[model samples]
Structures are given as C-alpha cells and as structure tokens.
Target: MDQKIPYDDYQLPVVFLPSYESPPAWIPPQERIQHPDYNNELTQFLPRTVVLKKPPGAQLGFNIRGGKASQLGIFISKVVPDSDAHRAGLQEGDQVLSVNEVDFQDIEHSRAVEILKSAREILMRVRFFPYNYQRQKERTVH
Candidate 1:
C-alpha cells in the first residue's frame, strides 16, 4: 500500500516564434516517382523466401533485409547437413527463379510456398538480370 500526497502546481512554456510573412521562391520542385519493373527483375520467391542468417532460437529471428523489399533472387540462408534441399542440388547460395515454369512474383506469398512444399519437387528456374550497360557507362564517365 502507498500513501498519496497532493501539493503541486505546474506551468508549461507558452512561447511563440515569429511567423514567416512570406515563403522564399527558391525551393526546388519535387521529382515524380517512377514505378518498379516487378514483373521483370523482382520475381517473388516465397513467403519464407527470406532465409534468416541463423536458426531461430527461443527468441524471434529475422531482420528487415531492406524491409518489404522485393529481391532479385533467392538467397540461401542455411545448408542442412542431411536434408532434401541439400540432397536435391540446392546449395547455400542458390537463387530460385521460377517454379513449374511460372514466375513467383505473379503469385502471392502464401500460394507460392504452399505450391513448393506440397509438390515435393518444385520445377524452379534460375534467371539473372543482365548488367545495365547504360548505367555503367554513365558511372564510368562521371
């Protein structure tokens, strides 16, 4: 149990800064946002496509690998000593491109992973984005 004592007076600061009479005219205009080519470069792998760096213990594991980010490929998180993944030519750094001849980005996370596990053998394609020659040339000149 605790005894209560009440004898307090409080006052907050009410200072006000001088208001701007007029804004300056030199502000630069904002740029228009560009849309991403999700269908081309960003092929969704799976909901669990994000492989944690290490095994999840009692505490929650997984980080914002650039959060909500659609990555280019599937990065291998772990290599089980004796597992089907390891047995089926899946390496630690393998990138999954397509499953059953269909791109993953076309499907949502839940559907993609379910299709993968249930089917036992996923017909995944591995594709890579060609280097951007224009961007490379610009960087070289700069």
Candidate 2:
C-alpha cells in the first residue's frame, strides 16, 4: 500500500529575494556616458579673473609670452614667487584672455607686455590651457 502526504502538512522554506527595477529601454546605458574631463576643450579649461595692484615703481611679478607674432594667445611664461601675480593665483602657462576689458586674443607680444607693465591695477581674465599652448608650441617648432 502506497502512502500519500497531505499538501497542508508539507513545510516550505521561506525565501527572501531582492527585487530590482529595470531601467527604461529609452535610457542609454551608463557605459555610454561621455566623460568630458578626459578631452581637451575650451570648456574644460579653468577660467579665472586675476587682479593685481602694482605698488609705486614695483613690478607686476609675472612675465608673458606669445601673441600675434607667434600665432598664439598671450600666455604667462613666469610667475615670481610671493609677488602680486603669484599671490593673485597667476601661474605659468596660463593664457590671458583679456586685460582691463581689453582683448588680448590677437594683440602683439610687445603691446601685451607694455600693457601689463604700464598698468597700475591690472584686471585680467585668464584660463589654464596648457594643452593648447603645447600644441601651438609644437606647430611653431615644426
């Protein structure tokens, strides 16, 4: 004789499973997201405004290079330590976009230098774009 077990008498182990909602099909995968910081673009550069006040007969404490002659924008070549420029967050290789509202994008190297030296209070808009500067240097060298 065969014995049959009752369904109600059987014990089932309790299970707790984590549930995840699937992302919408319209949404792109996270792997597709573009990381902009890895690329070189004007937007990636850090733009800043630096104000330097020159004391009577005192130097601005930074040297600039590049301009129309070089087919490049004005770039800070040197920044004297503990000087007004350095203290104002100026660094070597920074491109000067403007000075006291005057555009430096296409100014001559000599004119740019003269403006920087003659100003009592220099307000400059600059950005750190070493990548472009390096590319320009390479082009000029070749």
Candidate 3:
C-alpha cells in the first residue's frame, strides 16, 4: 500500500483537464424537431428584411400560421413555388418577426393575416433557421 501511494500522487486532478465545451447552440422550441446548425456562421439568426410588391388583388404566395397571440411570433408554413414570396427567399420554417415595420409578436393570428391581406406593399422581417429538408417535408405530410 505504501508503494502504491507514491504513484497515485502523480495523477492529475479532474480540474486540470481541459475545460468543458459550451453546450450545443440552442435551437428555438418551435424548431426543435428541425435540426438547426450548432454554429450559424453567416446568418447568426439575424432578422432579414424582405420587401414584396404585389399588384392589386394578388396573393403574397406564402402561408403563415400564428403562434400564441400573447407571444408575438408566426411561422411561415409554406411558400408557393415561383411566387413573389418564393422569389423573395421566404422558406418554410422561417419565423415572421414583423410585417410593415410593425412587430407582430403579440398580434392575434387572424389579425396578422388580415394585416397581410390588406397591404399592397409588404415589408417583412423574418428569422430563418433552415431545418432539415426531409424533416420539413415530413412535418407537412402528417
């Protein structure tokens, strides 16, 4: 036992080990099912402003679903191919942060839709965290 004690003293303590890496980047709760990048190099979750000019009686060509009315967030459920929204880079799983310079975070879903429908020129600021394409398709199916 005496001889073994000398060897034990040479071992490094746990604290001497390399520091723990930070926890994997957090993906928002709504985007959990969709795999978000651990490190967003280019975008970094910044809000992007997209401007769309739709002629009278034209659709914006995107579908949106509102989050809790009190919370103020909405999901872009779909973007029609070759539509104005499509050309504008609107993607499924993008979160709509505001419309027309007005924050929609706390607005009711129907009210937000109404605002969108009523506007001829739309200015939208959105956060896009691209999820897995396959997973997004699955969510749409069922």
Candidate 4:
C-alpha cells in the first residue's frame, strides 16, 4: 500500500548452489578452545597467584566488592608492600583483568590457580580494561 500498489516493484530472485567437498575423516579437527585466559572484568578472578590465609572453608578469591560499588573491581587488593606482584606493577586496588595477556574470565578457578602456581618466576600477559560489576552498570569514573 505504501508503494501505490505497483505490480512492477519487485520480482522473484534467482538462487545459486555451490558444490560441496567433504574432508577425510582421518584429518584431526582444529582446536575450538578459546585462549582460556581472556579476562572479562565483570567476572570474578581465581586469585591464582597468592598463598594467602583464606577464610575457614573458603577458597582463594578476588575481592570483587572491595572498592567503589560502581567501580568495585577497578582496584587491586592487598598488594604486599614489597612483593613480586608489587614489583610487577601490581598496586593495591588496581583493577586486575589479566595475567600474561590472558583474561581470568576465560578459565576455571582451579586451572587458573595451577597456572599461577606452576612457577614463581614467570612473566604473564596482562590487560587493564575497565570492568563493570554487573551488566546494568557501564559508566566509568576514570
């Protein structure tokens, strides 16, 4: 009706099909796993690097609520006055989102702990992206 009822306005379109070739079953499939370390800020970190005294019956955890409620995760927690993390540019309340270019959000906490504890003197790829605690919040103070 919007086109003034014109019969020449359109036509049925033609379709084309391509040939298919199947791969041999012997060929191994490529890996589908993501990097397993791509950290997303809204997620809780496994705290894989620390050997801290956890609460009774508690496991290693990142302080997800230790900062401004809106920017809750922007701050790193309890970096030692002069520890490896402190030396490695980790500051108290510095939002942590990565270790060696891998995000904490990409893997399970157990796997992350193993990766962090495998070696005491390893360099990790780290990224610092603003994270929202919940999907509803996105405004950043910085």
TM-score of each: 0.34, 0.65, 0.60, 0.32
Off by over 4 Å in 2: 1-44, 136-142
Q: How does model 1 fare in lDDT?
A: 0.37
- Could you give the candidate ranking by TM-score, starting with the highest? 2, 3, 1, 4
Which pairs of residues collide in candidate 2?
none
The 10 consecutive residues of candidate 2 with the worst lDDT sum are 31-40
**On a 0 to 100 scale, what is the lDDT of residue 74 in model 2?**
85
What lDDT is obtained when candidate 3 is compared to the true structure?
0.74
**Candidate-wise lDDT, in order:** 0.37, 0.80, 0.74, 0.41
**Candidate 4 residues 1-142, lDDT tens each?**
4544354554656344587788544422343233334333443333434323333444233322222334333334345555546555544444444455556544444445554454434444433333433321343332
Q: Lowest-scoring 10 consecutive residues by lDDT in candidate 4?
A: 59-68
Which candidate has the top score in TM-score? 2
Q: Taking the tens digit of each residue's C-alpha lDDT, what string does model 2 give over 1-142?
A: 9786676666786444688888655534554456443343546477889998887789889887778867778888789999878988888779999999999999988899888888899999999988767755655422
Model 1 Cα lDDT, one tens digit per residue, 9-123: 3244444469768854443334212323224335322222322122222211111011012333333334465554555444443444456665653444445545455453345
lDDT for position 107 in model 4: 49
Higher-scoring candidate on TM-score, 1 or 3 = 3
**Weakest lDDT window of 10 consecutive positions for candidate 3:** 133-142
TM-score of candidate 4 against the unseen true structure: 0.32
For model 4, the stretches where C-alpha displacement exceeds 4 angstroms are: 1-76, 92-103, 133-142
The alpha-carbon root-mean-square deviation between model 1 and the true structure, to one decimal in Å, is 17.5
